[model samples]
Target chain A: MVKLLRSDFRRLWRSKLFYLGITAVAASVAFGLINNVHYKRIMLNLEIPIDNILFLGTLVIGFAIAIFTSFFVGTEYSDGTMRSKVVVGHNRSMIYLSHFLTTTFAAVFMMVIGTAVIVVVGIPWMGSFVTSCTILLPQILCCLLSIVALNAMILLLAMLIPSKAICAIVCLVLVMVMTNMISPTLWSKLEADPIIPEMSYTDSEGVVHTQPEQPNPHYATGTTRTILQLCYDMLPTAQMYQYGYDKIPKNIHLFPLYSVLFIGVLSTVGACAFRRRDLK
Target chain B: MEYVLTTSALSKKYRNFEALKDMTMHIPKGSIYGFVGRNGAGKTTLIRVICGLQEPTSGEYTLYGISNKDRRIAKSRHRMGAVVETPSIYLDMTAEDNLKQQALVLGLPSYERIPEILKLVGLENTGKKKARHFSLGMKQRLGIAVALIGNPDFIVLDEPINGLDPQGIVEVRELILKLNHEHGITVLISSHILGELSKLATHYGFIEKGHVVKEISAAELEAVCRRCIKVEVSDTKALIRVLDRMKKDYEVISDTQANIYGVVVLSELVLALAEEKCDLLASHEQDENLETYFINLVGGGENG
Candidate 1:
């Protein structure tokens, strides 16, 4: 397994996609910085948190990592290197795990580059951290873990699906739909109960009536809210969305735990599927 | 003789199609074993199963005397290397880098031998040229170089010379010979070109429709496919008696026909037949090549 990991890392280091992923992350960070500068100048009251910048930067970075991982792992099937590894006596579990680790490393590497860029440029542009170090540090850890969890999901897809083009399409679509649809929808559902504002109404006798603010029953509560929060904690994309908006959950530690669980489940399932797969 | 690999009633099925059925074969150590079969004749399927790329639906095989079901089979496979169908190589890496990756996979102590392995496959001068830019022949050689990283004793090559030009074919052929002869590495090569295989194989396994119809040594095959005189005689009983008395190897085809292996004197044969009151009807010289022998063994036709 150590040998397989070394070989996979060597190949990963030489892969053009790895460098491209880093470049994309760095460029997106610069773009984010420029946009923040423009927004700050135009609307002096608009304050962008460093956490938001780091988390949002990771969203784009996560997508870039997904694309990088899809092609990186996909080439094994396309070029028949996986079969070569198997033929040379490498265990299937080791092959799968090594690829997973290499991809995870690529994701983390890109995140590090993006985070560095954000801190260097973002600290000056957005002023010092609005949130204290105690809160910001944990959120940063959760955000990085979320990126790893997303990478694991993509790695699973890449390993199981044999075709490069199909794997790339599925991975891209998955990342988009998860972040754009499911995560945000769950987060929106879990938002605190809506506050209905006061309103005045005219009676038939020309008398005016005022109603005070009240909690909207239509908003999620009880079991529904609990389920939504649980889903938000479990979904990596939801974690990213929460961090992007600086709405760090009270149970922030659950994010890393969930990420670890996701990595375990995906790696287990991916290795089993890969073991049974018939290489063409 | 010690066999490097053996399959016992191995079978593989895909949905409704049976790729291999009750197939059994033996590859002797230190011999270039030619796997002769047409396209889709279970050649690659068998290779895939042995390489652990696909599992056998039934039965099992042993590598280096370790059964497939045994946990030690994984360790046993370290002695084996294969290039199934196409050369399994990373096209983005240079020749040396590809070899280094393989060495890493094999858990070698160091890559000091990579240079020697590259020179063995004639790719030492490839330098920084990535494999994707290499010609078909160079790519194939690089694949072989990767396989040779750990110095595996048993190598399986599937259609190694499939798409090569004449020069490339010669290079690959010579490389196979060098590996088998000087290195004493056992090789199992499958090829559609029988003539080229004939030059390399010391043994042959002729498979058709998911089963091996014939397995013969090069010497035995040479004897069977040797030039012979087909004689039509009036009496086989009398001819057999005479041929046996003269110590000749011959196969009695029917009551009136027999194939006399090796050279024969026509006057002596006629006189001997006459002595038994049998007359010679007709005679013709017959010589069979590997392709014709394979076609005949499989029952010649389009399907064959």
Candidate 2:
């Protein structure tokens, strides 16, 4: 197994596609950071929080890293190398595990480097604001976890789908679209109800006047909040967004634990499927 | 002794089509076995199955006397190497790196033998040049070098000479001979190139329609090939009279044709033929080559 992993690692390192992806992601992250800082300084004229800038910059970097991890696995499947791996007497389960580890390590490596570069370069530019280790550390760790989870989800789709490009594009588009489209409406539905019922006595014959009665807006029930929290917790990025950067949840810690479990389960399922798939 | 390799009614079914049907083969040890068949004759499938790439639908095989059903078959397979269909080398890597990767797969201890392996394949001087830039012959050699890792005693090469130049083919032929004769390795080589295989094979397995029709040693094949002498005769009776008088070893093929095997005095034969009122027609010698022999064995058809 060690020997197999060594060979796979060497192949990955020698691959031009892997290096090209890293360079592409690095370039994009640097460009986004430089542009974001310059615009904030000139246009807004307000003191920009380094945390906010870091968070925004890391989000874009995370997306790039996540998409590349998913695409790499898909490319291996389509390129016939995966079949070659099977031919060499390595177990299929080991092959999937090796690939998953490689991709996750690569994703985390890229995310850390990108985040470090942006924060180090952009923080000094801030006039008087000091970066807090308390917030920055957990935020960066959560960001890494979020990217890992995102990669797991995308890799699951990649394993199921035929075309790598189509899989990557569809996964990225769906994640962005679904998170934006569904989260807000679901949040609103979980929030307090605006409408109230007014009851007054009415005379049947004379039609006595009835006065409008205002009732207090009712907040979400504990059960409804728990369900919403469970849904958010099932997604790692949602969990990170809810509790990351030293922010504690007021209602429940359902988001973080659920998302971690969700990501772990998804990753395992993808690995198993990949292990059983016959490469033609 | 049990054969080094044996398959019992081995078969493979692909979707609605059966690629191989109850095919069984026994390959003895220390023989350069030539697997002769046309393209798509399930040669590759058989190789792949032995290599553990595809599962056989029914039946079983044994390698080194261990049954495929045995848990230790995989361990037995470690003694074997194969170049199935194409060389499984990474074209993006250098020849040295390619062999290194294969060595890693086979769990070699050190890089000490890598240079020797490269030199053995005549690829030691490739330097850092990647496999993509290598010529087709070079790539094939690299693939063989990769297979040679871990010093596997048994190697299966699927059409190793296919698509190579004459020089490249000769190089490969010499390499296979050296491996078998000098290193005591067993080679199972499959190819449509019958003539090339005839030069090196110790035994031949002639396959047709996914079945091995004949398996014979080179000595037996040569003996059965029938080197014949050609002679022309006016009449068989006259030829017989001449043959009787001269006591020559010959066969009276027909009234106009005969095969003379022993030496004959032309003047004496002519006189005898004249005395019997017989005339010589025409004579020519014939040597049956491997190609003609193969065509004769399998008969003329699309595969022939």
Candidate 3:
């Protein structure tokens, strides 16, 4: 296992993908920081909270992580580089694990560094409104784990998909759509409040009555918050982020545990399928 | 002597296409085994299966007396190296870095062996120059260097000289010979280049349409491909009479021609034929080259 990891690390370090990803992450963070300052200056009322600003920056960083993971693994698969490893008598399981760990670690490291740069740049602009180091530290750690989820999800798709271009495009789309769809559900579950309908109401009518003054609960309440929330709550990513947000009970730490277990299972299944697949 | 690598009824099917069909081969220890075939004749498929890149649909193979079904087959395979189809090196890494990666994969204790392996493949001074900048020959040498990292006793090379210049081909040929002669590494080389293979191979297996049609040693093949004096005689019956008196080994190719597989004194044979009332229209010494022998063995077709 160590041997396999070392090989993958060397390959990843030598490839242009690593440098390109780091540059991309740095540029995106710089852009986000500059854009936040400009937007704040343009509209004095648009007071962006430092926590939300950093959160949004890390969210963009998550997408970058997803792209990096896909390309890193996808390039090898596309070019038939894995053939040598397979031919060299290495265990296929070890190969998958090595790539998975290396890519995931890289994603986390890039995001952390990118986030640090953003925070440093934001200190003068945001003044005292900047996020506290204490809160920001854990958020950064949780943000890294969240980005790992994105990495796992994207890596799984790249392994299963045949075409690199198609795999990468589809992975980004799936992650953007699914993460958007899954986050609010997690927020709703952790906060114990619905994401839509504007207001929760109780009527004091004489007989049993329902308030229909809200923005249609049937559609608005469940679209992003109800059904998908249940689904997201069942996922490890949702659980990990929810626990890290300090919204759930301490006992709910099991979510990250479940997340780890679930990701492990999915990655194993992906690796097995990849192993059985015929290289073109 | 026990065989170093043997396949018994080994077969691999990719969905509906049967890539290999009961390919049973025996490569004796220390022998330079030549796996000869045209493209899609299951050469690469067999190599992939033996290297564990793909599983066989049916049948088994043994490495150094260890059966594929046995748990110890992996341990047995640890002593093997292979370069399948193309050079499998990271193009962005230098040749030395690529070797290091391979060494890492094989779990070598240190990077100490990297220098020696690089020297062996004649790539010692390619320090920090990435493989993408390498010439095709350099890339190929690096691939061989990567394969030799663990000092395996058995090596499989698939068309190692397929895309080389004359000089590159000579370099690879000499390297292969050195490996076998000095290092005692048994090699399985598969190629459609029968000429180059004929020079290096000690044993030959001719595969056609996923089947081993014939397997022969170098000596047997040489005997089968005997050099002969080809003669086109005006009167073939007279030519046979002349040959019968001399008691030489020959084959009657046609009614008007024959090939005599023996030393012939031109004047004596002409005199003998004249006495037998045979008119030798044309005569020439013919040595069977690999192309002719391959065509004779596997049926003739325009080289495609």
Candidate 4:
């Protein structure tokens, strides 16, 4: 397994996709920070806090990790380089584990690149974090765990699907679905105002009318809110979306635990399925 | 004689289709074992099973005396390398890089033999060109080079010459011979080309419909192969008539070619053909062809 990891890392280092991923992470961070800061400074004449955009890199890193993991690992299947490994006596589980760990490390390493860009490009434009380290550090840690979880999920798709093109398409589509559709929908449901605000209107005849406050039908309350919040926290994509929006969950302690479970369960399932697969 | 690989009643079924059933064969150490079969005859299936790419549905096999069930079978497999159906190489990498990657996988102590392996495969001059740009022949050679990096004693090549041009075929053939004769590498080559395999194989395993039909050493096969006189005549019909009157068994290959079975009296045959107003263009005494030998063993078919 050590040799396998070493070889995989060597390929990762040499892979153009790896460097390209780092560039994409930096570009995404730059894009998000520049777009936000430029918009606020020019139009609103307000300097945003570093806190608002500190997690910007993490948001882009999630997408970068998806594309990188798919192609990096998918190359083995596409090129048939995997056959020689099994032929030379490398256990199938070891192969799976090596890829899982290698891609995880790659995601973390790209996170570092993203963080550097945020500090270099973002801190100058927006002031330093107004939130104290005590509060800020855990949020960053959750972001890392979330990215790792996302990478592991992508690795599962890569392992099960052998065609590089198809695996890449699947990974890209899955991330897009999670980031764009599922996470935002959950947030919308959970963050609905509990009661509608009172409104006043004057008719054309000059008579004033008032509408009393009422319970907002769309608001998720009690158990429904709890389940929806838990689902949002459990999903890596939702975690990244929350980070991007700078919204802390009600139960902030649970995101890391959920990420770990996602990593463990997804990898275990993937390895078992890969073991039973009849490889070409 | 010792065998490097031996399979006993191996079976593999994909859904309801049995690719291999009760297939048994032995590949002796230090011999080029030719695995012959038609398409869909389970040749690749058997190779895949032995290479650990796929598991057998039943029965067992041993490599270097270690059973497949034994954990030590991995150690045994470390001494072998295989190219199944196509060359297993990273097309995006250069030949040198491909070898280096394989060396990393094998965990070789050093890269000293890499240059030698490259020269052996005739890719030494191709410094930075990736495998994607290589000709079919070079890619095939590079695949063999990757296999050789581990310095394994046994190598399995599945249809190595499948799509090579004449020049590529000769180069690959000579390389296979050099590997076996000079390096003493045990080779298990599976191909449908009997004429090509006959030139290199010291032993053979004939398979048909998921089972081995026969296993014979080259020497043994040569001794059992029929003897006949091949003749290219101006009129095969006249020659056939003369042969029938003489009570001899013969087969017509074409309008002007035929093989007379058994030892023939050339002088008597010529006089008989002369009386029939037929001229023999050419005549040669040789052992029955490998294709004929295979057809005789497995019954005539397109592959044979």
The C-alpha lDDT values of all candidates are: 0.88, 0.71, 0.76, 0.89
Model 1, span A105-193: residue lDDT tens = 88988888888888888888677777788878877777888888888889888988888889999988888998889987886776655
Q: Model 1: per-residue lDDT, tens digit, B89-149?
A: 8988899888888888899999999989989999999899989999999989988888888
lDDT of 2: 0.71
lDDT of 2 by residue, B187-213 (tens): 999988988999989888887777777
Pairs that collide, model 1: none
Which scores higher on DockQ, 1 or 2? 1
DockQ, all candidates in order: 0.78, 0.26, 0.44, 0.64
Better of 3 and 4 by TM-score: 4
| Fnat of each candidate | 0.82, 0.21, 0.48, 0.75
Question: RMSD for each model, in Å, please?
Answer: 3.1, 7.0, 6.0, 6.2
Clashing residue pairs for model 2: A233-A255, A233-A259
Structural similarity to truth (TM-score) of each candidate? 0.92, 0.75, 0.82, 0.89
For candidate 4, what is the lDDT?
0.89
Model 3 lDDT tens row, B213-272: 888888888877788899999988888888888898888899999999968887888999
- Candidate 4 chain B minimal-lDDT segment of 10 residues: B295-304
Residues A205-240, model 2: lDDT tens digits = 877676676644554557976776566555655543
Q: In candidate 2, which residue ranges exceed 4 Å CA deviation?
A: A55-88, A127-139, A153-280, B228-299, B302-304
Ranking by DockQ: 1, 4, 3, 2
Which whole-number lDDT from 0 to 100 does residue B154 have in model 3? 94
lDDT of 3 by residue, A75-138 (tens): 7765456776776566677777788899988887786677677668776667654546875565
Better of 1 and 4 by DockQ: 1
